[model samples]
Target: MKTMFKKHGPPPTAVEDATFRIRFAELSAGYAGHPVLHQLSAGIAAFTSTALVGPNGSGKSTLLGVLAGVIQPTAGKLHHAGGRPPAFVPQRGAVGDALPLTVRQTVEMGCWGARGLWRRLTRQDRAAVDSALERLGIADLATRQLGELSGGQRQRALIAQGLAQESDLLLLDEPTTGLDPEARERIAMLLTELVADGVTVVHATHDLDAARSADVCLLLREGRLVGQGHPRQVLTPSTFARIWQPA
Candidate 1:
């Protein structure tokens, strides 16, 4: 549940090369018997930032769950480049502050995947946690209680947890949902840097500006792919109006 995807099964009929870090063909998933993603076919290019843009309830979070291997796809073929579990950073609010976990302790949990929950962390694991905190500029806040931090700081800590996982793929859900402009910009910049470092990133966001900055955009409507490509090409004014206009 902490990491990964249903990547088994014969390849789908759709032709795809190694160019994409993730490939899902006719993928469908949801809670109980209800489907949120309807045979959605898409490819996420390696080492690039992909923005999942669509109106609410367009299966964004469900899709992330599929990619993270937390949700089993009800149907379709899904694959990841390395078959390794991706580090998934759920929305900050999704993580309850009542746990009373310290920042460093929370981040160290990312290592739980490599080592079981009750196992003691090795020196390397501790180093990875420390490095993740430093990378997110939260080294000084490592000992702070998660509930005591500001919105932006808390978000950084959550992201640091993902970073500590050391996965080639990273998935995030609305990382900038309620942040101020400056905080959003900082997280956005960090995402760009992660891509440069060769971690394929896919995030669902309502921030149209953030979508525009992505290397690729996947537009969804009614649980289906509507368009995809460079943000400028796929997120044109007309497209936005059509997708976001009042129902």
Candidate 2:
């Protein structure tokens, strides 16, 4: 897979004066005794949606963690086109047992990246929070406690927090997990709107149908990329059976 992607050369460094770009040249990470990925490489252009699809323990979440700078890679280069760091949205379950906080307060926490230790939010910051809430369709729930919202609404709040960061790249781990079909579609549509606004997104999911909505689909297995490119191109019946069907 590395050789195949290399054949096409790297994507452009400067893409349309866009917000940011990501280029991964030979990135690998795993436990101390064993490696999960080997010489993996790819280039993601600005404002494009890339979906990482594979079976369990395929390193999708690990890859996103590395991109978000939460986990350091064991080897290889993961470059951030611009100096601006990417925002990460973990699954809703990851938020368990946190201190009590309001939805607005949680969204305001997103501004922490833009604030100093002693700096407080100004009028502009408050306005940004309100705008983010509105964008995620959670304005009416702003004053509600984060613990009180339903699963879908909570997901929206988390996504809104990421958006409030004003980052060019957004890394999401199973953003639509546990949602009904309607909730899933709504989240997908929200992602499409984000792309239209020039925000690059890299999401990891197990659903092939959801993966197809992305511009690029990467089929990963046992920490290796088996296929890459358009969903229809990479997700053939043979590939599907090989990954999902039992031996």
Candidate 3:
């Protein structure tokens, strides 16, 4: 079978279009009857990198889960302009580290959504997994058990899994957390490359630097939208103080 992983060249220069890939209007969601995201409203641009920034318990993860369709909103509406399901990579802590799986095997799970369980992988599916491993620089560790790798290596493998899914929209939650600077940079660069290839990326993070690197930034506090705009505009010192300052 022909490979589904078509190599798109570098990301195209961004146009000044206001086209949005997803829109959340007055969205509210939570777990166990406790509201986490309150009346949140934002638009994620198509083929752009967006950083969801906020303090702990501010509903960043909840919002990301909603975007990825893993969680349903209790109220309000979410419209996907692209109408395609997104590939979601939750935090490393959320993943099962003790699973007896190799790096390649873990990455291959990304293809499950397309191929389904109990079905053998096609040549295209295998190709996509190989491509993702190479793209994430984890080919050398393909046979390595996920439990044996360092935090950074494990994170890369998870990211490769997300890539293998071949989804146009990728949602990640704190992918760079606990990684060293080099690993963080590698992940960031890969995300930029993905954006260049026309993949819309929305990652929830506490790293201010990572947030600043994105084309758009959405600030949240106490499950509410504090601001949304360019990084420089939305991440002002005052904004930081309001979110991180001890009450």
What C-alpha lDDT values do all the predictions have?
A: 0.88, 0.82, 0.88
TM-score for each candidate, following the candidate numbering: 0.93, 0.88, 0.91
Enumerate residue pairs that collide in model 2: none
Lowest lDDT 10-residue stretch of candidate 3: 1-10
The residue pairs found clashing in candidate 1 are 4-68, 4-69, 5-69
Where in model 3 is the C-alpha error above 4 Å?
1-18
Instruction: Give model 2 RMSD, 1 decimal.
Output: 4.3
Question: 118-153 in candidate 1: lDDT tens per residue?
Answer: 999999999999999999999999899999999999
Q: Which digits, one per residue and each the tens of the lDDT, describe model 3 over residues 1-247?
A: 0111122233212241238787776788999999999888778999999999999998999999999888888877676765457889999998887899999999999999878988999999899999999999999999999999999999999999999998899999999999999999999999999999999999999998899989999998899998999999989988998888875
List where candidate 2 sits over 4 angstroms from the true fold.
1-20, 116-118, 245-247
Instruction: Give the distance in Å from residue 193's predicted Cα in candidate 3 to where it truly belongs.
Output: 0.6
Distance from true location, Cα of 209 in model 3, Å: 1.0
